[model samples]
Target chain A: MTTPLLEVTDLKIHFFTDEGVVKAVDGVDLTIERGKTLCLVGESGCGKSVTSRAFMQIIRKPGKLVDGSMLYRFKKDDGTDEIIDLAKLDPKGKPIRQIRGQEIAMIFQEPMTSLSLMHTVGQQITELIRLHTGATKHEARNRAIEMLQRVGIPKPDRLIDEYPFRLSGGMRQRAMIAMALSCNPTMLIADEPTTALDVTTQAQILDLMLELQNDYGMALLFITHDLGVVAEIADDVAVMYLGKIVERSDADTIFNNPKHPYTQALLRSIPKIAMQRDELEPIKGMVPSPFRRPVNICQFQPRCNQRFEACSRVEPVSTLINENHSVRCLLYEDVAAVHQADTEAVAHG
Target chain B: MWQYILRRFTYMIFTVWIISLITFAVIQLPPGDYVSTMVSQMINSGMDELPPDFEQEVRAQYGLDQPIYVQYYKWMRNIIRDGEFGYSWIYRRDAKDIMVERLPASFAISAFSVLFIWMIALPIGIYSAVKQYSLADYTFTLIGFIGLAVPNFLFALILLFISYKYMDQAMIGLYSQKYETAPWSLAKFWDLVKHLWIPVVIIGTSGTAGLIRTMRANLLDELNKPYVDTARSKGLSETTLLWRYPVRHALNPFISTIGWILPSLIAGELIVSIVLNLPTSGPVIFNSLMDQDMYVAAGFILILSTLTVLGTFISDLMLALLDPRIRLS
Candidate 1:
């Protein structure tokens, strides 16, 4: 395939909080190509949001970039490619700034708070446009109005003068999208953007996003815990459990044949209309707190119904099963002698 | 919005009325009126023989013979009809005239202290918060604790001592010897500026430290907010991200502080005024209190409390303007 617009390899973002090192995003790998959507799906604390924040290097204080390489390839205005290792850029330096909001933009989970209440939504959009494009304020105003219209705000003129508090949740989320896309960024990272909206609004926001992605042709990194949303909008799906991606595949494969027990469990938990009326099975146990993560075992081994002796002794590494599927589960591993020896060791004990 | 302001304005009038009544009552609470205080002073100073009708004449001159509510009504009528706050027994001048002369000095120094306190506090607070746990943050944090620990009077005295010992100029008042009573001129202005620095430093240091601690805490909380993250993710420069988003969010409480700061500067300056010998209303009203100059003390109390109430109204108006969330409500 053409060079991925962004490729993250073995990314680890740890928050050095007072309690201890929180391995919030540990050894995650992700990729998204231009004009395509990749959904990073996980329950809370699985580090989907943290990994997306890694791209912008906007993680909160007490959070550190322990180790990672995020290689972002941009097609410059002249149509030639430039690749930069995003991890190494000083978060406060000049180069990262040029790429930020200009090359990449993001929408957040809480539409209520994602846009500053103190500033007019139009001013917010215009400010970003002006900052990145060096356009005159008047020109940016026009661009902001145009974006507000494109995002389906009525009376762009009046709405342009209004603050975020005046807008409804869907409208605010749309405003956020409008602001994020104003620069025609090379990539858009949306962290659970529609999770807070009502069902109808959520669908509309997803549709607006997909439509906007088509219009802008930007790579989309969509992070959400909602599998239905993943099924609806994701071109590629990566299922995360406890800060690691345990399964990666195209949407259909991720749903039809999830290999990792965590992904299978997540798929099972998605309520279906066709299923017999029954109480939904939540994953058997709570996600282990970051401070208590097992150092050398599969993080999901405790919760995995199919867990085994080897699962408790060693961390399971990703094993490629096909051109489009990868799984991190010993159940799918080709039973090697090391596992046999490990099982023997456990048996002797 | 106009309705809100009008309602607030009405409340302000009521507030001022209640404040004036309370101050008048409290001034009366000290067990003697101005004539008693004057007669006692005369007795202590060897003028033991009472002049015929001396107490009666003194009492009649100030209208002190009326009942309490009647006296209040007379005072309120004078204020309403002629803008007169009554007469100062000690200065033997109209209280309004005393206010006119003294208001400027108190306002100038106190206003400067308020402005100086905020200007110094906000930026330091923002910096300390954004770079929390950094060396500068720790250093400023230490200073902030020190500011909170030491009383304002002590801080003022320490500054006074330092200025006297080091500068040798004493920096004793809001103006130097020649300009203390001098009429307005560029020379007076410069001297005012020169003297202004000492009180501003004396008063502002502690205020700056206190506000910095508060602003830092408020901004730090806002810095973690989702809007701030969104702003940063949009690649707002660190300065832009700070000043425009989280700082703006953090400013509501700080703006509301304007009400507290207005009278605080004036009230907090009283002890400092005594220490530095500054010719501000603090010491003037303070002397009135000691001499039991009823009208002057009550008048100053009335004016300062009005300012405090007015300050709260102004801050509320500002809050409504600055925050749309509040504006809608």
Candidate 2:
């Protein structure tokens, strides 16, 4: 099988601040195959957004990617295998510039601010196209309008010249998406794209993104805290708690059989619209402060019900419970022995 | 917008008129009238001791023999109706001409100082903000305090010493020679600038310190704003992020204050020019006040007032440009 489009292995982002060193993203590993969607779910301050920003190499001052190897394996123009290590790419070098926007585009939260207030929405999109593709102004203009229309913007010809402030929140988001997608990038990193929109608009944007992903055959890295959103768009899910990935697996396995107590608590906390109010159970206790993180198997030990004494003594490694699913949890350590014991007992009974 | 301008202009006129009236009154109330002073000085110097009729002639010449209210009424009428600034007793020329000649010099010095101040402050301030608490920031802060603490006269003395000791030349104080040396030629103007630069810088150094501190504080605030982070997430270059968003936003307060900055600097230039003996408004007004040349003093005041008004207007326009939310309306 060919390598995935993007693979982030052992990613760690730390911040050196006046207070102390903060491990913002500790040992986060994620993969997105071609045309697949990987949703990162966590509460506020969980470092989900930091991990996504790390992918784009846009982490701000005082925050830095201390260690990480992000490998992008894609087919070059000559159909030759090309694998570039993102960690090795110089931030100012042409390779990173070539990948940013041309290969991977990002959709930011707060569309109004993300879109340049000074430029017309169309101009912003057209400029990006011209910058990456070297298209003539006229060609880029047409492409921009087409992208806007494809994104379901009304009267793309007229709307293109309007500023972001002139457009509604939903329309601005669509304009942002159009701008990001105008370059025809291979991967889309949507960083809470729908967090600021109204619920109805959120659904529309999510659907539009999914539709575009399908049409363009692009991989997606969706960074959000809303599990409801995850349930809808993600094929794979990663749960982060205090800068570390607490649990990660196929979406089905993660939703059905969450082994890590934090994952289970997160799953339980998501209020179900289909179920009664009383049936809903939210996660107990707040996420621990990153500054006060303990050296142990689980960062969730304080809130986790299944946490044992041993969990505080040593960190747990990821254990593969199935061919496609894996989780970092002490509870999953005896799964194979338990399965064998259950088989013998059932036969005797 | 037009209404706003009209209202501001009206208020400016009212303020100038009130200040001028108070100045006129105070100058008149002083002991030893201008006519008596002239006559006494003539007699004391034994300059043929003006004829016995000279006392009446001097009083009549100045219209000082008229009632105070009447003199004030005529003065107001001449200013309002004839648009005439009366002659100066000391200069023996129209007060308006003296003011016109001297106002530009003061303004030039002020303008040059302001330009230097902003040019130096902005970059240093921005770098200090970006480097925050680094050695550069601490060093600049220390330098700013020094600039603040040193008085203009002392600064002028220091500059003179530096020029004499290092450059092996005597420092220019104000003019090349005196006001009678030459008319305002380009060479003379440049010479005047060279002479005045030390004083101008001395006066402006404090202002530069203030501006640098303000810019640093503002830039820090802008850097911490969420929109700056949003800009970063858009894959914008660091230069663009710093200059386009943070710098522009940070400059709004400084830009808006330029109107006040220019006039206030001009006011400050007055004192510095006097100390440095520059042929500028400070000494001109100071001489007129001592000689009871009310017209020249009032005229100088009026010119400075006008500059302040115009400065504020320019600042308003700049604020609108710098701050997007300040719409044209």
lDDT (Cα atoms) of all candidates against the true structure: 0.86, 0.80
Per-residue lDDT over A251-308 for candidate 2, one digit per residue giving the tens place of the 0 to 100 score: 8888888878888888888776789889888777876667888764467777778877
- Fnat, model by model in order, equals 0.81, 0.11
- Backbone-clash count (model 2): 0
CA deviation > 4 Å runs, candidate 2: A116-123, A136-142, A155-161, A274-280, A335-349, B1-77, B87-93, B165-169, B178-180, B183-186, B189-193, B224-236, B287-294
Off by over 4 Å in 1: A274-279, A340-349, B45-61, B151-168
Tens digits of per-residue lDDT for model 1 on A1-349? 7679899999998898889889888898878888889999999988888888889888776788889799999777698988899999999888888888989888899998888888988888988998888999899999999999999999998999898888899999999999999998889989999889999999999999999988888889999999899988989999888888889999999888778888888878878887766767788889887899988677888898998778888667788899779888777777884477577757866
Write the residue-wise lDDT of candidate 2 on B42-123 in tens digits. Answer: 8788887567888888788778889877887888898889878899888789987887778777877888888889888899
Give the root-mean-square deviation of each candidate in angstroms: 2.4, 5.7
TM-score for the A chain of candidate 1: 0.96
lDDT per residue, candidate 1, B161-273, as tens digits?
A: 88779888777777788887789999999988988887786678778888898898998899888888888877778987888888888989988768878777887788888
Q: Candidate 1 docking category?
A: medium
Q: Estimate candidate 2's RMSD in Å.
A: 5.7
What DockQ score does model 1 reach against the true complex?
A: 0.78
